[model samples]
Target: MITTLLVANRGEIARRIFRTARAMGLATVAVYSDADADAPHVREADQAVRLGPAAARESYLNVEAVLAAARATGADAIHPGYGFLSENAAFAEVVTAEGLTWVGPPPAAIRAMGLKDAAKALMIAAGVPVTPGYHGESQDPAHLAREAGSIGYPILIKAVAGGGGKGMRKVERPADFTEALGAAKREAAAAFGDDRVLLETYVARPRHIEVQVFGDAHGQVVHLFERDCSLQRRHQKVIEEAPAPGMSDEVRQAVCAAAVRAARAVDYVGAGTVEFIADASAGLRADRIWFMEMNTRLQVEHPVTEAVTGQDLVEWQLRVAGGEPLPLTQDEITLNGWAMEARLYAENPAAGFLPSIGELEHFVLPESVRVDTGVEAGGAVSPHYDPMIAKLIAHGPSRRVAAHRLAAACAQVQVWPVRTNAGFLARCLEDADFLQGEVDTGFIAARLDALAGALAPSDQVLAAAAQGLLSQTPVPAAEPQGPWSALTGFRINGPRQGQVRLYRDGQAVTAPLVDGPLSADVLLNQAGAIVVFEAGEAFAFTGSPPQAITGEGPAGDGVVIAPMPGKVVAVAVSAGDKVLKGQTLVTLEAMKMEHALTAAFEGVVETISVAAGDQVSEGVVLARLTPSA
Candidate 1:
């Protein structure tokens, strides 16, 4: 009998579990690191505990700290929300051994499906079709090449350990196999400490479609249909939707049946996902889809599944952990409508999707969609964790309606100072190919250039910004009302005719005043910039600052400032060193990504303000350069 529940995680997923825990009449406890002390998940829980410092290893991933939190809160059940230790088999064992309910699958099941090679073998043994690959223990390069030849050209070399597209490489030619294999092995070793890899035939046009499977302790497993996750960037899912666009009834039955068989093979309990890879070169078919891998915990995209099936997955986890039978049988479960979800992250897409950490000075999400988030308007996006702060979901009777709704919702996001990928996501959802349901894993990569291009406020947005600026500057009470007078500000009855020059992306745009006022939302951010929400994208404009005020680049004239808050990892140049334009100067590490700061022009380094170990905030000068004579 589970009474109180402790979520051994943070951010959106933790809060997501807590929401369900509350509705089920169960108390909820939250554990957070120093970085997440004021996180939304913490305040929402009935009880909260501080694990340790800002580092995840000292807090979230520290098994002892987590157990202590649960014990202190008197929590009888623990839910390992996705990521961190959600897939750790040993953690699951420890939780159960402590006489506390583990809201997940058995430790044996997690271990069975932990490694790619072993998982495939189990699937094959269970009569579940898997991708044609070599999962043997032999690591000889020559032998692996031979197997690749049999599997045909364009094969993938994937590490057997962890996921998230790390330690994975695609070899399209026989000659490149050896080189790609070595690189994949090196990365695999560095990432997971295991160089062993498996090879599979690379599908020409691959679509990532996975079945959401739920099993109970009573030996019954049911599928909640499938979700199309083909819209991805570097194998990380960006946009996902339930009931794949073109999935036929026959194809769905075949894949879902295989998923059920795979789950039963390990006597799986609780929420799990069986991912499948489909060769969509000839469109989705029963014979084209093959088993990929299984996620032993609730997936990040589970909300879309719930939207389409009208079921609460977290409640299912709790009920099952309490030894209850399946809530609804296979026949009773049904897919209702099309549901789409876009991952809302605090990152700058135009700058290669680097994490952007700062206070949410002007945060506001769209009210037209279902939002699941772990941060608030006044919260800060911390660099100590993942950048994803929320998930936006939209459900409709048809796929097109859902896509349009989600796209509009993406456009309605109003975050400022801290950059976001909202604009990029809106473009992806509104893309012509995406709208027509023509997508594959490489869809985003193929059109990333256009999708992530630097966005400039539209004429309408410029007009809105100009009006907002005019309205706020306190117009002189003595201004002329004559038709010939310069109409510099917005008129109460209509838009006064005038021209306002606004700078965007370093270029000045001359915006002609609209004949009427716009319905666009506008706000004055803390940075003293006039912010206009274009569909939800924040367009901050300045009212033509002084010519000398470039905002950055002090009198030294060659200042290199940190683009975002990060730790200085390397100083490539010293005082008195000459460097060419575009040469690497310093490398900054933030949000698990490394960014190289470069010399904007040929110059001599005059001073070094930071070292390799120093943590720097955005706009902090890292080095000063003087133009070479």
Candidate 2:
């Protein structure tokens, strides 16, 4: 019997596991780094221990520190709630070797599905169909080139030890194969410490479908249906739904059966996911869906599966880890309703989806949906981790209703200073094609322009903001359009109608201020900045605008700046290089992901401020550009 459980991860996932552990009458412990001292998960745990500094290697990823924390807290069980070391086989081995219960699959199972090449071979031997690709142990570029030719043009180079969108690239022609392979290998080495790659035939119209399966030490394994995660941007999943739209009964049965078989072949235990890539040209046929890979841990989108199936998967994991039999047989598991989850990231979609990190001065998620978040009103989003703010999940009787509710909830998100992808997610959920279930893996990329467009402040919203600013600062008496017209000479008895000009995102707009209180959507931050909320987006405006001499005047500058603190991986351009707008100039790695800073305008590089491997801070100018001669 497990009396104390320690979650070896952070953020919302750790809190989620603690909730389940509490329900089972078990003490919960949380381990946090220096950067997470005041984090919600740390405060929520029954006992918390300090790991180390902010860097993951010195903290979360340090096996010794994690084990020491567990020892100090007297935790008999460890639940790695995805990411970090959740799928690390060696970590699992160490935990069990120390006489502590590992709330996950056997280490052998993790190793079996750890590398893409080995997992593909294992799945083939388990009678599960896999995508046509090369899974051999050859690093020769010429050999992989030959294999790519055999697979035909438009092949996908995937890092054998990678997940998410990193260490992956698509080659459309033979000429681009070498470069793409090298790039993929470099990223693979950086992310997974393995530069080995596997090739696959790129599915023409692909849909991502994965089955949630659970197994026990008693040789019992059952699947909890499937989730469709076709909506993605830059190969990262943004939204996921249960009971994949357009999935027929036959297809679900075939995939789930294969998933169970795959688990049995590896003697898997606890929560695992079997992912498949389906060619949607024919609308989700059993024969067209091919095995992708298996996740040897709980997934980020598990809430959707739990909602649709009406099961507490964490309870199942705890029971299985305690040497219990499967909670329910496959026949008893039933899919009830349609559910969807949207990952709200701290990023500005209008600004190349650049990650934003700052204090969450005022954060409010909709009460209408199930919100899983790690930060609260005063918490800050650090640059040392993933930028996801929260996850909003909604369930309904049908897919359309679920989408509607989810979209509404996303639009209702209230966050300031730190930008969020909520507005972008809401637009995606309300897209007509998305509503009709006519989506594929490329759905988000195709509609990114229409969905991520900047939220322009309407006339009413602008007026409300002006009113808010006027109410704070006494109304001016003369020179209605002067620089201090909105701030000088108080007029307590004059006509309430006063015009004030405010600048937002470097664009100047004038609106008439009225009497009475400011609108509900208008807010005043600590710095006295007027912020207007619309469709889950916060637009800050100021009465005093900066001089319009920088870059494109009234719209910021032509200097390329780092969005967050990161290590510069490469400098693609030097001083005096004539570059086109949107050309990649520098690439940096931060939060375990890569970001390529591009030229903001067609110009000649005037100066390079940073070099390769140099660490930079947020808002630091990386390179300066002047108009082309």
Task: Give candidate 1 misplaced runs (Cα > 4 Å).
Answer: 138-153, 171-196, 474-495, 546-589, 592-629
lDDT of 2 by residue, 188-243 (tens): 88888899999999999999999999999999999999999999987889999999
lDDT of 1 by residue, 1-629 (tens): 89999999999999889988888899999999999989989999999999999987799989999999999999999999998889999999999999999999999999998899999999999998899989999999999999999999899999898776666889999998987786677656644568899999898899999999999988889999999999988677999999998899999999999999999999999999999999999899989899989999999999999999999999999999999998999999998989999999898888878788889987889899999999988899988887898899999999999999999999989897888999899999999999999999999999988998777777888778777766766322223556655555546766565676666655666766676667678887555568887765778877665355556674237988887788886687899999999888887767654567888889999999999879998889899888888
What TM-score do all the candidates reach, one by one? 0.87, 0.93
Best by TM-score: 2
lDDT for model 2? 0.89
Candidate 1: worst-modelled 10 consecutive residues by lDDT: 474-483
